[model samples]
Target chain A: MMRRREARLGWLFISPAFFHLVVFALFPMGYALYLSFFKWHLIKDVRQYVGSSNYAFCLTDETFLHSLWNSAKYSLLSVPFGMALGLAVAILVNQKLRGISIFRTIYYIPAISSGVAIAMLWIYVYLPETGLLNSMALGLLGEHGRLTPMVASMLGKPDWHLASIDFLNSTQWAMIALAFMSGWGGLGPKMVLFLAGLLGIPQSLYEAAELDGAGRWRSFVSVTLPMLAPTTFFVLVTSTIGALQVFTPVYMMTKGGPDESTNVVGYQIYQEAWVTFHTGLAAAESFVLLALIAVVSLAQFRMMKSTLVGYATT
Target chain B: MRRKTWDKVRGALWATGLYALLIALAAFLLAPFVWMVLISVHPWNTPIPAISDLIPRGPDGQVHLDWSNYGLVLFDPNLPVARFLFNSAFVTLTVVVGQTLVSSLAAYGFAKLHFRGRELVFALFLGSMMFAGPVTQIPVYLLLRSLGWLDSYWALVVPGLSSAFSVFLLRQFFMQIPAELDEAARIDGAGDFRIYARVVMPLSKAALATAAAFTFFGVWTDFFNPLIYTNSVEMRTLEVGLSIYKNSYGGSNWPAQMTAAVIVMLPLLVVFLFVQRYFVKGIMLGSIK
Candidate 1:
């Protein structure tokens, strides 16, 4: 009798969350899987049962391929650089120096700010003539900055001007510029996570390393790096997922412009679903993305298995 | 003594290098924010200021502070900045409260109540986290449309009311609380709900606050949902509204755009300043386990 009553109460307690999960998450995911195999138009409301044609269409579609390439490129460029820079800064700010909290706060500000706002801010920062980056580049490589003539001569193009290199306007530099901004924006939270990981390492381990005459560099390589593997693995998986789904920046800043150079998979999915109203195609493309993310995440897990074992033991 | 002096000299060099690197990183991180503030106050109609001019000087060669950009952003007849702010605050608050309540209750069930199929249900909930947002985006939009909740607060709030991540986080925290308290409460004739309400919730304030903060920040900064769902100008959240504002008047009104950005970011920045420790702790807790 008591067990039955407890079971009833448990079910009652969890029903609300279960309802939400079914309504929002589980139902939608199932519906997405169903929709991926059908021909559904947003406006018409008539769903034709098409078997695997949407996936077939996505495979052959050049724009889909390009966007996938773009997303993969972005993940490749942003994830490693963001992790490295974040780890470097975390180590820097993790010191016992005075007022380190202030620096930590400033670094983390961008991560907490709205993505659209950050994109808006970066628009001005990346502005060609009067922007901060170009201005700095010009100062460094202009006629009087001493390196200007050498760079110009090396390029062997008299028209090569540092002031006119529009970071967001050109096809070659647009994706790279977005990657740089992403790296910068993501630095804070990544650093914070690393800082937490650094702090969690038992002080005794470091003391023992020092007692064994392990220098700072050697200890960092053996103790700090191994201990931090779990955090690094977590960051890698999450950031890879995040980078693949990069949308707001592309939407707010470039809108997949400059000859479709910045059209990542996430933005492409949005465009397909909303702009072209190809709901079925969009659903299929998202599945492809899901598959890719799963594959990459699995690869990361396999590669980092040894380090994770270290984490488990100590 | 001589060798110790050399070591001291090396240590001094290391400290100097570290400080220099830190200062440079600080400047890199903060300079853009400082520039945003400076440009927001600069006269909108004038030429873009030179890099050397951190603060713009008027044509009279005197320092002039122009508050017109802020005025334009806040009171522009077409923009509806205040409405967007209200919508964002309303939706964010609802999600924060609703998610915290629902997630905590569910967490309590998972953490304290032992019943049949408990582990299975919890595993299903955890599995839901693996499904990324885009995978479910279209279906949810369609579901909301069918419910006739499009372009309304229902579309924004209802779908986001319960988060798997929040439930997971709260469950982790709840499991750490000793079961003896609940057992003691049961001996005192308190029911499960009563124990949860009076005992578990009180002890779990930090966890609850952490969940609330994450939900608040996520909902506040979310642009993709608001962009896709809310078509009407009044239904728009601040992030989407600012993006629309940028699209329409960004080129001619750079200062006003910056002002609008500042307005959108100010509330969260203030909230973060007050609960900075909880925010960091939440990140640490969420990431570590």
Candidate 2:
């Protein structure tokens, strides 16, 4: 009798969350899958049954392909750099010293700020004239800098001649600039995760390594690196997924500008659905992105599993 | 004695290098916000100041501060800054409270209740985390359109009431609470709801605060949903409002735009400053496990 009541209460407790999941999450996914097969436009109220044509169109679409490639390139550039900088900062701040929390707080501020705000700030930072980046680069390169003239001469075109290159307008540098901004903004949260992982590492492990005459670098490589495998894995997977879905910066800063060089798959979906009102094509593209993420995540899990097992035996 | 001296020299060198690196990283993280503040107070109708001239001079060669930018942005006819702020606050508060209550209840059930298919239900909730936002963006918009909820607060608040990530985080924390407390409460004839409300909730304050902070931060800073759902200036949140301002008057009034940006960003920064420990603890709890 009590068991029955307990189960009843359990069902009651979960009903609210379950309702939201069905309405907001699961149902939308199901509806998206269903809608992908039809040609639908919300504004025009046009719905026609077109079986797999949307998917076929996406497959052959050059814009879609380029956006996918852009997303992949973005993920490649940001994830590793973000992780490395995060880990470096984490190690630096992990030291037992005075006023370390101040440094941690400074690093974490960008992570908590609005994405649009960061994007806006970076827009100013990347402006060609009087922007922070160009000013700093000019200062670093000195008067008539070697690399500036070299880059200008390499292009060898009269139009390409410039004292300082425009970071956002130039196709060659836009994606890289965006990636650096993302990596910098993302460093805080990633560092916090690494710091947490670092704190969890037992001090005795380092002591034992010291007793064995191991240097600091050796202990870090063997002890700290292996123990942090799980944190590293988690950060890698989450950050890669985040990089793949990046939209706000692209929208706010570049609008995928300077010849569509910065157009990412996520922004492409937005434009298709909202701007062009091609809901069916947008849905198909979303599914394509879903499939790509699943494959990459599963591959990462499999690769990490073998390495984790290797560490366990050793 | 010689060996000790060599070790001391190396240690001092390492400390200096570490401090140098830390300062450099801090500057990289903070320079933009510093510049934003400087530019916001900079006198209008001047060229964008150099890094050296952060505090620009007026035509009179006196250091004239431009406090008018804040007034201009706040009182702008097109922007509706106060209304947007109120909208953002309302939406953020509702989502945070609703998500906390719903996720906590579900977490309690998952942590303590022995119902059939419990593991399966939890697994399903976890699986939903991998569903990217784009996958659901259009369908949810369509669903809202059918329900006649577009350009309304219901569109923002209702769909965001439950989060799988919050549920997972709370469930982990709930599981760590001793079952003996629940049993003791039961012995006193307190039912499951009573124990959940009185016993479990009180003991899980740290986790609850962390979850609330995370939800607050996420909702307050979210731009994508607000942009899509709201059509008019009256309904826009602070993020979308600020972006609209940037799009419209960005070139002519750079200081006003920076002022608006700073205003939008200030609240979360203040909240973060006060309860920073909880924020870090919350992040650690969510990620490390």
Number of the top TM-score candidate = 2
lDDT digits (tens) for residues B118-223 of candidate 2: 8888887887887646699998998998999999999989988999989989988999889998999999999889999999999999899888888989999998
| Residues forming the 10-long window of minimal summed lDDT in candidate 1 chain B | B45-54
DockQ list for all candidates: 0.72, 0.75
Please give, for residues A123-234, the per-residue lDDT of candidate 1 as tens digits: 8888887788877777778655557877788999865655556888899999999999998898878998999999999999999999999999999998999989989999
The runs of at least 3 residues in candidate 2 whose Cα sits more than 4 Å from the true structure, single-residue gaps closed, are A142-162, B1-12
- CA lDDT of every candidate: 0.88, 0.88
* Candidate 2 CAPRI grade: medium
Could you report the Cα RMSD, in angstroms, for every candidate shown?
2.6, 3.0
Which stretch of 10 consecutive residues in model 2 chain A shows the poorest summed lDDT? A139-148
So what's the TM-score on candidate 2?
A: 0.95
Any idea how many clashes model 1 has?
0
Cα error of candidate 2 at position A18, Å: 0.8
Report the lDDT tens digits of candidate 2 across residue range A1-314. 97888888888899899888888888899999999999999799799999999999999999999999999999999999999999989999999767889989888999989887787788889887678888777754535544565666677853343357788888999999999999899988899999999999999999999999999899999899988888998999899889999999999988997899999999999999999999998999999999998889889999889989998898
